[model samples]
Target: MVAGRSGNTQLVAALDRKASALGLYVGQPLANARAMVPALRVVAEDAPADAKLLARIADWCDRYTPFVALDPPRGLLLDVSGVGHLFDGEQALLDRIRAELRRQGFAVRGAMASTALAARALARHRDGCVVAPGDESKAVAPLPIEALDLDEPATHAFRRAGLKTIGQAAGRKRAELTARFGSRLVYMIDTALARANAPISPRRPLPDYRAERNFAEPVATEDIIRQTLLALAGALSELLEKRGEGARRLEAVFFRADGIVRRIAVEAGAPLREPNAMVRLFHEKLAALADPLDPGFGFDLIRLCADRIGRAEAEAQQLDSDAGRERELRLLVDRLAARFGRDRILAFHPCDTNIPEHAFALLPAQHAGPAERPWKKLRGAKEAPRRPLRLFARPERLGLLRAVDGRYHMRWRNTQRLLTRIEGPERIAMEWWRSAEPTRDYYRVEDENGRRFWLCRDAQSGQWSVQGGFA
Candidate 1:
């Protein structure tokens, strides 16, 4: 029983066979119910708790199929299109679902039809309902107009016009009904009778590949579980190799005997296909979990799925020893990343831009391939390192003056420094599309102490600053 408007206690929201037999209906006043039955027990309604339990029940249904949706207030929809054959047939599958949910202390009602709306209506309104493919309109005719979920005004209008059952509404002119009440009513009836299309939305992403093992008796030993995972990985790897593709992310789901499910996931730094390598990565991932996986009461089923996939080209044995060495080095890096973490290992990638500060960026080592375009060099110049070995994040200002002899003199940090020789005025203008900073004229200068320094003069401000240093 729950509270109604004006703080008055209302009728029961739900009741069993005995209460119904005693002439008690849902939404009936609680005071009237107690008067009808002197000795009665009642509990407060908890909408949130009921919704949470329903969600968990929907999750448990994933062992059957990944496409499970909730029909709020109390209903669940499972689109078992291709999965029905796995459990023998549609009737047998429905029976299994009902039996399992009933065993878990739920009063479950199930029905199957060609359309979701028809199946839902049958499950709610009829017992043991299974509508044949072509018999939808006949089967739905007996149900009331309220089954279409029309608004209160429309339902009252239908009742006032002597339309009580679906048959009465369907017998009327389709054009008149659509014109009077809009297309929603017509669409609802069409959907309910399998005339219109209704699609199911899955709660989880469909995996690229999935493999499952169902044990006659639950098994919980760690060694056996690990072996099972390795076997599944081997099979999946073989499948991937045949398609010339590899998995970038994999997930393992352990469905326990007591209706509890646990999932462990691992991400690959690169496209991976080797059976042994995949197993090793999962081992490392499982070991690194903050909370160790517990196979409480054993697991009745285990499934391995490839969540993300990518193309993997089969490489021929390299003839050059250097190429072979590079391959080995990459393999080592992949192994290290698998054991520690992906972000812990990184490499610099050249960015396609003219600005010196935006020339390169750090990316994951596994994905750090050469840029689309190589860095442009000076025209007719030999390959040489022009940029300084160490560039400061920001240039430091220097108090310097150009002498009459075209030489530079500066006193930095209270120490006198003289430029004995200079190399260039490699002018680099600021990328106006990116920033409004002034242009700079860069020069490679050697001080009297033989230390090579990179200096720049801001063209707009005429200010000098030290940018970098050479070895």
Candidate 2:
């Protein structure tokens, strides 16, 4: 019997009696569904919630095998090659999954076969059928052609021509089928019969090394978690060393008693296989978390995965005496970033431009280094007319008293600062496509006290402002 809710008494009674209740054959529209039964309740589909539930199910299915991927929108594809025997055969494994999902309040159907196509067909059309390794064709043969997940138009076309069962389609010559229905139908049939292979691509790639620890009791203290993480890092380092590789990224997952998983990821500048370094990096990251690690009742499981691996590289120690000074500088920057945020620490890199304002760019100190002269070979690579070491994030405007011979004198911050020298009034035209266009004539000037400043005159308004200062 088809155990599903329906508004129409005729369709529901027909489905209950197992009398060809093709869900596709109902031919009732939503408006019609409501007209048939005024008391019928309809609900919108919750796709995201369904997807998250499927992901949780896939994680639970990891006990069966590590190779599990979502069949998308619905269903899951599990690679149960050599692992099925551990559960006492494919049927037992399928039964186990079905029972477990049922216990978890899910209405599930399962099928096991030598190929994914056969399994998908059997699961959708013949739920109870279990196709042995070499008997995929025989198992799929009795099922309807619609089991192939064909489009509605194609299904209707096939049905109109009296080709219903897969066995009937299989009886026809491959050349005839391809000529009549196109290559897609032929390909689907071939794949379902195991004559062609269909592979499943996982959403997430498998990690290189995975280590898990299930605690007898939950622990929430940072000290204990750090110690446990150190141990896991040591074990992971050993694995990488044996493989002659190093991990570029490490992910630590803490599975709490409440069933929520918290993940922390660490990325290394270089591939790393040092246990202490890995633990230290994670410790630094953990110390920066805003939320307290409440561990609630306690964490049940802790899993560490090395995601990206690369060939291990050997480093040679520098003989220069300045090595210690470099290390001290790095340590200072790391501490400042840890406390004040990495954005607060900045480095400057030269840009390819003659304009003083565009001569350099600011970048995060953690990811940027001192500007180098590697591009010295490029034409016009020389530094532009000396720019101020300190530039305001934005130019501050000042009300000028007067323009003496095209030289403006101004008062800023309630202090009198004179523009002693002036250079060419270099006009920068605006890109009109974008709004707020500005035309400015810039000048390099020095105050009486030998302080150099970069000032610009707004040509349109005849207003002057100090853009930057040389420290």
Candidate 3:
């Protein structure tokens, strides 16, 4: 099965052993492939899904080493330097990884070297290779120049100069190579030979506290997994308390046997140190997943980590119940956020704008606590014009408004009513420097039925609209 953009129908990207034996090669046109074998089948390319699967595979590789990085398109880089001895040596670890993936039904190739570039090149080009420390150059010398991953023009120049193998290119003078092909070729050769260096960026942030469990046999039941999480959370809580900090965000990673990884993340509305609270939050997060987690063939390793932390300290007992009430409220917020999503639970924060519509903004509850930004009181008046309990998102237009000798009469919702009382002519001007907007004179008017409405009249147009109503 394969895909390409040569035509609308399809093109070959890969083929099975039978197809290869019958002379079908990758990048061969689909029309040509079908002609070769009438029974050939082709499928559409799902690049995004493939990329996601690749990411999951990278997550699973964390079981081997925390320093796993993506190599893009379809590859991964694992920095197994200090960790390889855990499996009894680099060779044993590589063999174990290969055997596990193969058992999970994937065709895998692996190689190890002192440098990431050399290891990646060998994995893609050579097979079953182990370039011992200080021997990277000798091992990759015989491989083709393509292993350097040079641009096509540079590769063609190298070929034209009769430098076909990496060894031949290595033999040339560095200054001479730079003069002919620019500094890129020189730098690439140095990197491939482990003479130059680069770094691998891990997919996730390194945690402050990490506790992991590796099983002799894979564990599949959800209850058992929860029990593991409970234990890890207990250990993590103790660590956080000793450090005088609390976890604000935590991540639980399950490494399945079949190269699939499932991750559950939970965030706390306030700094959280209780292990039981953390466990409950994770349960809510896992239950809210749109796709139920499946432990296919079971998980071989599970790790718990505190991804985000914050300073926390024990507070003195309050004379009143205010502190207890605040704690309870934050706990409720955390639970609701875990179930309904963080964005779904929000708190209003004041914005630096006078216009009612632009006066405030909503932020996630976990991000914007009640005290994050204090509410600003209107200037000048001790008893300001009472704002409606509920303000309209946009003011509703009124059909007819008339003032009868200081008293008001208005037609609203197909009914005419005489306003018994009127309180304001609060004038608010638009920020003229920002935009051209009409100034408004707002009035609190009470109708015959005693229902009070906030009405705004455009000073320029003399048109009135009902903005909101008091409770």
Q: What's the TM-score of each model vs. the native?
A: 0.75, 0.73, 0.85
Position 204, candidate 2: lDDT:
65
| Candidate 3 lDDT over residue span 1-471, tens digit each | 766555565678766677899999876888898898898777767778878878877777889888888987678889898887799988889988888777867778889988888887788787667788888899878888988777778889889999998889989999999999888778778777888877778887778777889898999998899999899899998998898999999998888877788878899977888888899998988898899779999988999989889998966645449887887778788988998899999888887767765777889978885554567766467764466756888888886555657666878777888988888798889999998989988888888998888888899998888888986
- Report the Cα lDDT for residue 368, model 3: 88
| Winner of 1 and 3 under TM-score | 3
- Per-model lDDT: 0.80, 0.73, 0.83
Per-candidate total of colliding backbone pairs: 1, 0, 0
| Candidates 2 and 3, the one with greater lDDT | 3
Tens-digit per-residue lDDT, 27-74, candidate 2? 345455556555554454456776897887777665566578898767
Q: Where in model 2 is the C-alpha error above 4 Å?
A: 1-39, 55-68, 79-99, 125-132, 157-164, 214-225, 255-260, 290-301, 316-346, 364-385, 403-408, 413-452, 458-463
C-alpha positional error of residue 358 in candidate 1 after TM-score superposition, expressed in Å: 1.4
Error of 2 at 123 (Å): 2.4
Candidate 1: 10-residue stretch with minimal lDDT: 1-10
lDDT-wise, the better of 1 and 2 is 1
Worst 10 residues of 2 by lDDT: 13-22
The best candidate in terms of TM-score = 3
